[model samples]
Target: MSVPPENLHPRSRLVHDALRAAGILGEIVVLPDAASTAALAAAALGIEVGAIANSLVFWSDDEPLLVMTSGAHRVDTAALAERLGRGRISRASVEQVREATGQAIGGVAPTGHPAPIVTVVDEDLAAFDQIWAAGGTPHTVFPLTYDELVRLTGGTVAKVD
Candidate 1:
C-alpha cells in the first residue's frame, strides 16, 4: 500500500498560504522528498513531464534570476546570459538560493520570494494547459495555469531554455 503524506511542514504550509493569498485556488500535492524532480513528480502524479514547471535559480553576477523552465528542456545559461546582456549565468548555491528566495533548492516557487527577483518563464511551458510547481517544500507542489502563473509571478515569458 502507498503511504499518506505528512502535510505539516512549515515550508509547505507557507506555500499553501502564499498561494491562497495570491488568489491561486488549487489543491496541493505532497510526495516523498525523492519525488521532487520533474520526472519523479510526473511519475508519482501520473502526469506528463511537460506539465512540470521546474523552478531553477541562477546567479547573474551577484543578482538572483529565477527561471521557470519546462521539464522537457535544459536551460542554456550562456544563451540566457547573452539574451539578458548579463556578465554570466550560473547555478546558485544553496546559501545564495536561500538568501535570495527565502526558500530551499527543491521548493522555490515563482512567488513568495524575500524580494522581487527577476523571473523568466520558458515559453515551452506555455504549451501545457496546467503546470505543477514547487510549493516551498520539496514534497509539496501546486497546480496553476500558464497565464495564472505569469500573472501571479509577474514573470516574463521568454525562451530561456
Candidate 2:
C-alpha cells in the first residue's frame, strides 16, 4: 500500500501538492537508497537511464534555468547558451540551487519551487514513453510523460545536446 500524500516529508508533500494541482496523479516512489543521480534512479526503478529526466540547475544572467535533460545525455552549456541567447551558462552553486529550487542539488524537481523558474526541456526526453523525475528529494521520484513535463514546467523544448 502507498503512503498518503500528507504522510510524505514536507518537501515531498509540497511536490505532491504541486503535481496534483497540475493534474498529475503519479504517485511518488521512495527508494531505499538515495537516488540522487539519474543513473541511480534508473537502476533503482529498473528503467533505462535515458528515460530519467535529470533536473539540472544552471545560472545565466543571474536567473535560474532548469534543464530537464535526458539522463543519458549531458547538457552542452556553451551550445545551449547560444541557442537560448544567454551569455555564459554555468552550473548553479549548492546555495543558489537551494535558494532557487527549495531542494537539494541531487533532488531538484521541475516544479515546487518558491517561484516559477525559467525551464527548458530537452527534446531527447520526448523519445521515452515515460520519464521519471526527482520528487523534491534525493530518495523520492515520480513518473510523468513528456507532454506532462513540458506542460508542468511550461518549459521550452529544445535540443540540449
Most lDDT-accurate candidate: 2
lDDT of 2 by residue, 51-74 (tens): 999999999988989999999999
TM-score of 1: 0.89
Q: TM-scores across all candidates? A: 0.89, 0.98
Query: How far is 159's C-alpha from truth in model 2 (Å)?
Result: 0.6
Instruction: Enumerate clash totals for all models, in the order shown.
Output: 0, 0
Pairs in steric clash, model 2:
none
Residue 3's lDDT within candidate 1 is 18
In the predicted model 1, the residue pairs found to clash are none
* lDDT against true structure, model 2: 0.94
Best by TM-score: 2
Predicted structure 1: lDDT = 0.81
